[model samples]
Target: MDFLTSSTHLHITAWVVALVLFLVGAFVSKSKGIHMALRLFYILTIITGGALFIEAMDYGMGMQYGIKFLLGILVIGMMEMILVRQKKNKPTTMFWILFAVFLFAVLYMGFKLPMGQNFLA
Candidate 1:
């Protein structure tokens, strides 16, 4: 139980795995297996993230957590949007750009915000 909540362990782990999965999907564009794995990672991310958000709320950091949570979901959405566009053989330049921007923002906020990892600390 302690491990689950400690230092946002679960949430971080899920995101790391999801990142790897995302990369796999990107590299293996036509692989349904990679796509399925990426989808699973998305679910894992959401579950772990929800747990962390609830914990944050208990510590009176709900607003900060909420923003991060939404950004995280947006990141996932961007990934799916890219995949969808690719599947349809449509241009994905815009979605790719948005994904990169959102990914940077989410990572920056997660490590910089006081309510988050505050990696500098």
Candidate 2:
């Protein structure tokens, strides 16, 4: 669909996918099925995010795009650390805090700020 090819559509879709993953991951953190689903969702999140970044760069929105990429990496790293690390230390609280901060930042970028002038244009 033409909408899928549009930058706005891609951006929105990325956010939707990320949110869904976050929610489902939370709900099914202890289940093998949910864990597998979350993992696949994260992989898709990364791919879609990369596509969005490329689109932004192609449109000359480099700084904003770079910030987004960095944030994404930070979030993904946090996620991996939370999910893959051995349960030696109790880090759930810290991970949740980090996730909250990242979510807030994403919201600021997506809704509260002038995204076009801030990042790409």
Candidate 3:
């Protein structure tokens, strides 16, 4: 468990790969295999994120980490909605918009957090 939560590298990589998977699922293919892979990545991301949140709580900023977790979940939900809607031949414009907004918020908060890499912070 310590190994999983020791650093942010794994967390970052998981989410980044999930983002790429999202992009591929968005415009490239609607294959079930891709969707399943994306879902797997989502789980990996949340697990890693939870580990980070526990670490962040040690900094005495639980609220910020909580908000980040919520936003991260929203981002994941939005991704799922977009892909599902896309498959159903439904409009995903709003989902895409929300995804962008939530993703930006989460990523910004991530970089601004104490444990973050001080990326553009």
Candidate 4:
């Protein structure tokens, strides 16, 4: 119970939930319900990410935090482009590639990288 209230725990929980939602959304692309769920999931992701950014800034992990924030924004932008642009094969392929790179970067920052070490430590 106490762990649930800890900042590090909360951050991890948020990221895990976001990642799961992203995977589910991607896999269930044929369903409108899943698409809507993805939108809501993304909203939660943004909110939690913003909170983590603020915490990082306050504690002096600014560089890592900034990088993560930029990556998140880029991912969201690419997704928006994919959704709004005409359904053409070339554009769709390009968008998916960009999104894949963005996802990789986000995972690196969120997991493999030491971005949140200061807070977690």
Candidate 5:
């Protein structure tokens, strides 16, 4: 839809909300309800991210966008891993570290890319 491609608001909002949900799921509560909601936001984030990826291809920056995409997936995977391991009462120090690193990488690339929004640049 035009609204999706017109801006990155949806993608940004999805991830931001997901991050909040992740925090709640990870620290405040281990309820399945929060995890399920987080999963849904993950889907929303991916869909909007895919739209942006496709748009980036038109600019001949497929390689960079592709890397960003992979990093995004890693971030998502790390989030899921942290929550699951937390629920299982296992230590997640490494996963938490990786999550922060990957999330930072993805966000940096997102802002550095030649998109409608580039707050970092």
Candidate 6:
């Protein structure tokens, strides 16, 4: 469906789902089911995000797009690090804090950047 490939729809939908899953994992107990679900959401977010980046390339935004792509990967990495630390019974506070910071950064960039057809557009 055209809607599925549309950058706006895909990015927003994936991020919203990922954010909800992140909240659940952070605030509530992390169960195996939740972990798998979160992984699925992460994959979906990356795929959709990559698609958005490719589409945005046509607009010739240059390094901004690349930076967001890398930051997005870091955000995902931070999330995985948080979960891994938790599973290892290690100190997750630092990872959790970093995750939050990176998440905020990604969100700020996503909203501020003139990339896709956002809701305000």
lDDT of each: 0.82, 0.61, 0.94, 0.64, 0.91, 0.77
CA RMSD of each candidate after superposition = 1.9, 4.4, 0.7, 4.5, 1.1, 2.3
Every model's TM-score:
0.87, 0.68, 0.97, 0.67, 0.95, 0.85
Candidate 5 residue pairs in backbone clash? none
lDDT of 6 by residue, 1-121 (tens): 3455564777788778877887788669678787788889889888888777777777788578878878888888888888777778899888778877887877777876786545444
**Clash number by candidate, in order:** 0, 2, 0, 0, 0, 0
- In model 6, residue pairs whose N, Cα or C atoms come closer than 3 Å (at least 3 residues apart or on different chains), thus clashing, are none
| Cα lDDT, model 1, residue 107 | 90
Tell me the spans in candidate 4 whose CA falls farther than 4 Å from its real position.
1-5, 8-28, 83-90, 112-121
lDDT of 4 by residue, 4-24 (tens): 324555656655665665556
For this target, which candidate reaches the highest lDDT against the unseen true structure?
Answer: 3
- Lowest-scoring 10 consecutive residues by lDDT in candidate 2? 112-121
For model 2 the local lDDT of residue 120 reads 28
Top TM-score prediction, candidate number: 3
Lowest lDDT 10-residue stretch of candidate 6: 1-10
Off by over 4 Å in 2: 1-5, 8-11, 14-18, 27-29, 84-89, 112-121
Between which residue pairs do clashes occur in model 3? none
Better of 1 and 2 by lDDT: 1
lDDT (10s digit) by residue, model 2, range 2-121:
343354555556556656765666555555565566566667666666666666666566787767667766776666556544234555778767967876676566453343324522
Please estimate how well model 3 matches the true structure, expressed as its whole-model Cα lDDT. Answer: 0.94
Residue 114, model 6, lDDT: 81
Candidate 4, overall lDDT?
Answer: 0.64
Per residue, candidate 3 scores C-alpha lDDT tens digits across 1-121 of: 9977888999999999999999999999889999999999999999999988988889999999999999999999999999999999999999999999999999999999888889684
Ranking of predictions according to lDDT: 3, 5, 1, 6, 4, 2
lDDT of 5: 0.91
